[model samples]
Target: MVGTAAQHFVAVHGVGHGAWVYYKVKPRMEAAGVRFTPVSLAAAGNNGKKLEEVRSLHDYTTPLLEVLAAVPAGEKVVLVGHSGGGYPAAYAMEKFPEKISVAVFVNALMPDTKNRPSYVIDEYLARTPPEAWMDTQFPTYGDPPITALVVGPKFISDSLYNLSPVEDQALGHLSVRPGSLFMEDLATMDKFSDDKFGSVRRAYIVAADDKTIPAEFQRWLIENNPVAEVKEIKGADHMPMFTQPDALCKCLLEIAQKHAA
Candidate 1:
C-alpha cells in the first residue's frame, strides 16, 4: 500500500568505494519507479577529496550526513548502506532517527552503540594478509598513524568481487580508493542510545557467498544489533550491487513496502 506506488532511497557505498559502485543499481531502481540517490562519502569515489584529508569519523561520513540533512522535513527516507557504508547509516540513524524510516545493511558492517567500526574492521583484517591485501599505513596523519586502508586489486577479485562480471570486477579494482579507517574517530563517536538508533527499524541483506564480510559475520552482526527482518541474496559476493542488482533492488523494495506508512 504505502510503498506500492513509489518510495525514496538513499544508498551509501562501502569503504574504498564511491558513488560509482551504485551505478548498476540506479538505472534498475529508476526503471522500477523507485527514487534512488547513491552517495559517495567524502574522500571516496570522485569526491575529489584525498584520503589524507579525512581525519575523523565525521570527516569520513560527512557526505552522507549532508545528503540526509538535505531531505525535506516530514519526508522520511530509507537509508541503505553496503560494506563499510554501514557505519554512516548507523550514525545517521542515531543523529536523525526521525528522518529515517528504515536502515538497511547490505552485506555490510552493523556496528551498535557498544560497537565500533575499528573493531568490525579488525575482525575482517584478521582473516586476510594485511601486507598483501591492504595498505596498513600512509603519511596521512601524524604520531599515532591515522593512515587510510586501501584494498588491493587482487584481494578485491577474490573476496569482494568474486561473483561479479569480469569487467565489473576490473572496474571495481581500478575505481576503489583508499578509505579512511577512522579508528580514533569511531572510538569516540561510537556511543548511541537505544532511544535514538535503536528506535529506528533495521533490516539486513546478507550476501550468502560474501567472502569480504562473510555470511557468518553478517549473522553475528544481526544477532548483536538485531533487526526486524533478514533477506538473502544467494551467490552474491560482497558487491551485490554489481553481482545481483536485480535481487538487491527487489529486496530493498520489499523492505520499503513492508515498512511503508
Candidate 2:
C-alpha cells in the first residue's frame, strides 16, 4: 500500500455515471491503505438530480470544487477523471491548481489551455443524433447556450466500450445522459492551457485497446503536454474500473506513489 499526500482519492466518472461507479476502485484503494472520496455531479450518479439541471461544465464541476476546497491545508490530491468527467477535472485544475498535485486522464478528453473540451465532442458530432431530434428535444431537457444533445453525452458511440465485460457495458448504458455542453469552460481558464499544463507534472494511463478515446489520442494528449508521464495498462478497456481493477489499482497506486515521492 502506498500513502498519498491526502488519504482520499477524488474521482469523477465518465458519462452516465456518478461516483458510485468507482466503487470497485474505491475499495481497492482503501484496502491498499489509501482513502477514497467519490462524489456525484449535480445530475450525476444517484444524486437523484435531474439530467437537465446539470447543463454546463461549471454546474457539473461545482461538487468537485467543493471537495477540493475542503482538503486539509498543505495536503495535495491526484484528480482522477474518467471519460466525460475530464471536463470537470480540467476545470478543477484551473480554479484550484494548487489543490491538485497531479491529474490522471482516463479515456477522457485531455484538453490543454488553448484546446477546448468541446473538441472532444466535435470529433464525434457527425455520428451523433440527427440534427432534428438534437436541435429540438435537447433544448427542452437542457437549456440553450449548452451543447447538450450533440456534444455532451449524446455523441458517445457504443463502440467505445467494445472490450468491456458485460456488466460494465450495461452500467455504461444506464449512465448515458447528454452533458450540458461537451467541452469545459475550464479550458478557457488562464493557467489551464497548453503551455500551462506543460509546466505541471502530469501522468496518463493508456488503455491498450480503448476505442472510446483511442490510444492514439491519449498519446497525442500526453505528447501535447510535455510534462506528463505515461503508463500502459494491458488488455484494459476504456472503463478500467470494471474491466481491469487490479491493473487500474496498480496504475493508481503507482501514480499516487510517484506523487507521494
Candidate 3:
C-alpha cells in the first residue's frame, strides 16, 4: 500500500480508445488515496474533434500537454500510457520532465531516445503486417496520406478484449474511434534527448497474455528501450483494466509506492 502522501496518476489511452477505458482503474486508484485523471486525446473518446481535424502529432498530444501544464509547479504526477498512448507519454516526458514523477508503459510502445519517435511504431507495423491485423482497417487520409487505424470488432474481440468481460467488449465496440499513427509528422520530428525523456523514471507492465502485442514483440520493445523496471500480469490480455483489474491495480499501486515516493 502507498503511504499517506497521495500520488497523482494521469492515464493516456491508446489508439481508438478514450478516457473511458480507465473507468475501472480510476475508482480503484482513487480509493487507495491516489488522484487519477484519465485524458482523451484529440478525436478519441467523447472528444468532439473529428479524425480529419487532428493533422499532426502536436494536435493529438495537445490535451495531454494541457493537463501536464496544469499540474502544480512543485508536484509531479505518474504518467501511465497504455498501448499506442506511449507516444504522447514519451512526448510529455520530453516536454515536461520535471512535472512527471515516472512514466509507465502498459503493454504499450516504448520508444528509445536514440531514434526518431516514429521508429518504434514503424517497427511495430513491420512486425505486424497488414494480414496480421485481420479486419482492422488502415485507411489513409490527407494530401500526404496520413494513415489512420480503425480497429474492427473482430480484431478487438480476438486480440484486444480476448480476456475482458462481455460488457467491456461491448463498450469497446461502441466507443472506439479512428486513430492516426501520425507517422509522417513523427518521422520528421527530432529524436528524444537523454537529458529530458531519459532523465524521468520509466517502468513497464507487461500483460502476459496480450495477443495484440505478442509476448515476443513486447520483450523486443523492452530490449530496445530498457526501463528502470519491468512487471508482468499473468493471463492479462491487451485490456488488462477489464480482464485483470485487481492485478493491474496492484502493479500500479506498487509502482506508485516505489517510483512516486
Candidate 4:
C-alpha cells in the first residue's frame, strides 16, 4: 500500500447518488482526524439545483472544481470518486493535478477520454438486461434534451443496494434525484493525455460482488487504465460505502496514508 498526505480528503458520488451515500463512512475519516468533503453532483442530494439546469459538464462539475480550488497551494488532497463520480474526478485531476495527491476510484468509472460517456451506460445496459435495471430511465437525444437520468426505486434495491441495510435502501429511494450522463459533452471532448490526467497517481477499490459494474468489467477498467495499486473486498456490492463501511474506511485510510502525501 502506498502512503498519502493525511490532511484533506474529498469524495464524489455516482449518478443518482448524493454525498449522503458516504455518510456511513464519513465518521471513520473524521475519527482519524482527516478533513472530509462529500460532494453532491449538480442536481443530486441537497444541492437544490434542478435537473434541467445542468446543461453542460461545466455546470455539473463546478462544485467539485471549486472545492479543489479552495485547497491551499503546496497542500494536496486525496480525491476519491464512486461510480459516475470518477469522470468528474478525472476531469478535476486534469484541470488541477497539483491539488490532488491521489485519485481513488471505488467501483467507479475509470475514464480515459478515449471512451465516450455513452459507452459507460451502454456497457452497463449491454451486460445487464432491461429487467435488471428495472424502471431506470434515460433522456432522449433531441433538440429539447431530457437533461437528466433517473433510476427507479426497484432498480435501486435490485442492482445498487442489494447488500445494504433495508432502512438505508429506503433512504436511497426517498432521496435519489435525476442526474446527467454528460454523453454530449464527452462525445466532443479530447482524450486525456499522459502529461495531464495520466500524471496523477491513482488507485482502484474493487467491490467483488458488484452487480452494477461486475467484477469482470471492473478488472477490464483496471486493465484499460492502470493504477498504482489495486485493493479488493469480496461480497461488496456497487454501494460498498453502506454494505462495507468498516472495510471501506480501512481501505480509504490506507490509501490516504500510503498514496495521498
Across residues 6-106, which tens digit of lDDT does each residue of candidate 2 receive?
A: 45678898765678778788888888888778878767777667766665677778888899999888877778888777768877787777777788877
lDDT of candidate 1? 0.81
lDDT (C-alpha) at residue 217 in model 1: 86
Model 2 spans with C-alpha error above 4 angstroms: 4-6, 116-145, 149-158, 181-199
Task: List the global CA lDDT of all models.
Answer: 0.81, 0.67, 0.90, 0.82
| lDDT for each residue of candidate 4 in 190-249, tens digit (9 for 90 to 100) | 776677788899999999998888888888888877899899988799899989988888
Per-residue lDDT over 1-261 for candidate 3, one digit per residue giving the tens place of the 0 to 100 score = 542346889999999899999999888888878788999999999888998889897899899999999998999999999999988899899999999988999999888998888898888888886776888988998887888999999999988999989999999999999998788899999999999999999999999999898877888999998988899999899998999887888898898788887
RMSD of 4: 2.3
Clashes of each: 0, 6, 0, 13
Better of 2 and 4 by lDDT: 4
The candidate that achieves the highest TM-score relative to the unseen native structure = 3
Candidate 1: tens digits of C-alpha lDDT, residues 1-261:
123444789988988888898898888887777789998888898897887777777777888888888889998899999988888888888888988998999998887766554666666667655454542334356556686676777778777788899999889868988886676676656467689888999999999998777798899888877899999999799899988988998998889988755
Weakest 10 consecutive residues of candidate 3 by summed lDDT: 1-10
TM-score, ranked from best to worst: 3, 4, 1, 2
Where does candidate 3 stray beyond 4 Å? 2-4
How high is the lDDT of residue 190 in model 2? Answer: 47
Show the colliding residue pairs in model 1. none
lDDT of 2: 0.67
What TM-score against the true fold does each predicted structure earn? Answer: 0.91, 0.81, 0.97, 0.92
